[model samples]
Target: MSRVTVQLNGRDFTIGCEEGQEAYLRELAGSLDKRVSEISGQVGQIGDLRLLLMASLILVDDLKESDRKIAELEGQAQRLRHENHGAASLQAEARNELTAHLTRLAERMESFADTLEAAGDDSDGDGGVPAPDTSLAEAGA
Candidate 1:
């Protein structure tokens, strides 16, 4: 551990941090001191305890605002995920419906083939020249 002395409101305080984290700790301390000085200057003749309490309140408010922003972003992400899920489900349902409709069309084409075959047979019995059944699909032909 390493110790750093930080002066806030004209008082020196020592805080501990890991050796490599000195720069970050120092920067954090500097920022806090700046905030305290800014506040103390506006509210002159403030007690040390009251000054610290006010600083704590300011820091806590900042933390809370950061947390609130994070929560809002998380909610946005979840809503987007929900919308994507709904769209995917709708696409799947559409594909299934299209498949069913195509199958029905194929069945109707097969029924038409049977009717044409019967009509050809009837025409032959009546001694009429049978017109060609040119409408047969390649697969059925």
Candidate 2:
């Protein structure tokens, strides 16, 4: 345990805290003293107890507001994450569909090429039409 002396409302008070937390305690006391002074100035040096209570209430209210804002921001972040996940899923689905479509198109093209090859093989490489009788034409000439 560590002991720390802090001044608040122009009075010194000793507080106990963990060994390494003296500086942190002093910092908190400074903030509280500032708040108390502000309250005293506003309410014209009301009793110490009354000033302390008012300062504590104000601090609690501020804390509550901060907590509410933090929760709202967390909710917004979660919603954005969900929306992003949905968009990613949609993109993946689109990619998969495109790949499948291209695969089918490629298969159809290959089938058409095979059919043309078979037709070509049935002829003397002249598209099944005998070459015009070039020798006969030459004889006539």
Candidate 3:
């Protein structure tokens, strides 16, 4: 345990805290003293208890406001996260759909190529008619 002497309203008070928290305690005391002094100035040196009470209330109000803001920010963050997750899912679904479409188109093109190849083979060997002359231009020249 550690003891720290803090001056508030021109009075020194001893406070006890954990060993490593002496500095933190002193800092808190300093802030409280400043608040009390401000209140005293406004209210003209009212009783120490009343000044302290008013300061405590003000501090509590500030803390509550801060808590509310933090909660609001956290809610916004959660909503944004949900929206991003939905967007990512939509993108993945679109990618999958595109992949399936491309696969089908490739299969169709392969079938068309096979059909054309079969027709060419038939013209060359399976039919009784002679193949069309591809070298007619050269022969004339």
Runs in model 3 with CA error above 4 Å?
125-141
The TM-scores, one per candidate, come to: 0.73, 0.83, 0.83
Report the lDDT tens digits of candidate 3 across residue range 1-141: 888898888999998888999888888989999999999888888899999999999999999999999999999999999999999999999999999999999899778656655655678575764544547423431
lDDT of 2: 0.86
Q: Per-residue lDDT of 1-141 in model 2, one digit per residue for the tens?
A: 999999999989998999899999999999999999998888888888888899999999999999999999999999999999999999999999999999999899778655655655566764654444446445532
lDDT of each: 0.84, 0.86, 0.85
Q: What is the lDDT of residue 60 in candidate 1?
A: 100
Residue pairs whose backbone atoms clash in candidate 3: none
Backbone clashes in model 2:
0
Q: Which residue pairs collide, candidate 2?
A: none
The ten-residue window of minimal lDDT in model 2 covers 132-141
lDDT of 1 by residue, 1-141 (tens): 999887778888898989899888878878988888888899974888888789899999999999999999999999999999999999999999999999999899878777777777667556574644566544575
Runs of candidate 1 with Cα error greater than 4 angstroms are: 117-141
